[model samples]
Target: MDWDKLRIFHAVADAGSLTHAGESLHLSQSAVSRQIRALEESLNTTLFRRHARGLILTEQGELLFEATRTMTKRLDATAARIRDSEDEVFGELRVTTTLGFGTLWLLPRLPRLFALYPNLKIDLMLEEKLLDLPMREADVAIRMKEPSQAELIRRRLMDVRICFYANADYVARNGMPETAEALADHRLITQSPSSPQVRAGLEFSQPFVAAANHSAMTVNTYFGILQGVIHGIGIGSLPDYVTADFPDLVRVLPDVQSATIPVYLAYVEELRHSKRVCAFRDFVLEEIQSFRRRALPEAPETGHAMTP
Candidate 1:
């Protein structure tokens, strides 16, 4: 089994089309097909069932895929470990962020980073889904979560203070609640993972517990929830940064208290001391610290900076 040839075949199998795999590998369709044929001939087994639409893996290919995928991941990680020698922060850096942040923040400002570090390559992945870092799916993940794991190097970048908000029309129509207890009159929209400690900290005395059971519509995504609230479906707890910037939303209960959601920037420690990784870490920390300092409404000056 030639390792490189096997790798090409693996790409073809995963992509389901030789042309797609070729595009990914920066090779042509004929070259990839020849490599696949050579690999099958050497193994003396049929790997793919050819079809007009695309290729389907045979039982042999399935068995091979299970091993190949793992090997590819290991190979990628090993390569990163080896490439750690490049002290200039050169080569591709894969990063992932949430949709709203990606749209309003990261994507717009990425050009500055590019201008600052011309040598470092960046691949910014924008999805609401959190990516696995250690597997090399993404080198970094920005998420709203309390950091608990050991394998990751977690840094609490900011406390995403969330408060209830509604459109001005909705607030005007329903009237504003004076206290947390009075919020039951308005439709309350919220999400879970609100630990007991957080609720206690917020002094959430609101009796809108019915909102938990009879939510207008249950959505798993923050963007959808925000849209629902913006359209007058209900009142939603939006991040202060988002609310502070969003023109259409208005904070209804600014005094009732808000839940502080810990935002974390996490990465696999496998490349902890690597020069490129270190360069990226330092750059991200510097950028985020500045962003949090300048942007966050309640950010403290000193201890508020996310410590390692």
Candidate 2:
């Protein structure tokens, strides 16, 4: 019922010590302890269990902490929204995407974004795990597959395919594979089948593994595979988007490729009017468009539409 007491309790529970919470909140430890006691009396239940080390949350305290955590996030979101100006794009924007795409594609292009909005802060989260947008785990996402989350405003960015590639020197040294069967003589660099990756990419890479007789290297992220290929280790299975920046990589066994993986950009519906979200969405869309235009002619002919 008391907002200040609830805030103090949340802090104390978070730190597991009244002294630590008090230091953070600019209050004396005794004052924080008194507030917690008052809150426990108000709720008619024990909120914490004190021991020689620190306080542990009682069952009731756990429930209240969960509520307060959610409240804190929602309040932070509200404050962020309030701080955003219609004409100025500033403040933190959390973006989530697969590690491969984040490192290979998006991260390199972020300088242009910063050039436009010098004050903007970007928290780039690169992982295979999909973050929950609606729950505020991440403010935006660029995913290989269409997002199934509700209350999300999503846009189709482009279609990407997994293709075999090798550095020019490696190709010159080892010779290019003309057919899937020819891959038997070359060392293959690829994401391990056991690693977390798109089903389509895994399915596409299976035949190559089955065909390879030479030694192979398996890495969890596409970035590692690219590195292996760059250093003349082996031919790698890589996304087509890499060609724009890594122009020296020669497309090998062009006919052997994966089905199109649709890339999507999505954000929570609540962020529809948020200027930062709009700016980021537009910037990504523009970048994708530019990439498609520049890379299309040089892109190996898979005899399929690569654009959305």
Give the best candidate by TM-score.
Answer: 2
Clashing pairs in model 1, backbone N/Cα/C closer than 3 A: none
Where's the lowest-lDDT run of ten residues in candidate 1? 193-202
Q: Distance from true position, residue 298, model 1, in Å?
A: 4.1
lDDT of 2 by residue, 98-176 (tens): 9999999999999999999998999999999999888888899999988997578888788899999999999888898
Worst 10 residues of 2 by lDDT: 299-308
What's the distance in Å from true for residue 262, model 2?
A: 0.9
The TM-score between candidate 2 and the true structure equals 0.90
Q: Per model, state how many residue pairs clash.
A: 0, 0
Model 1 over residues 44-135: C-alpha lDDT tens digits?
99999989889999999999998898788778767877787765657777778776566655666677777777887877897756677766
Estimate the overall C-alpha local distance difference test score of candidate 1.
Answer: 0.71
lDDT of 1 at 33: 94
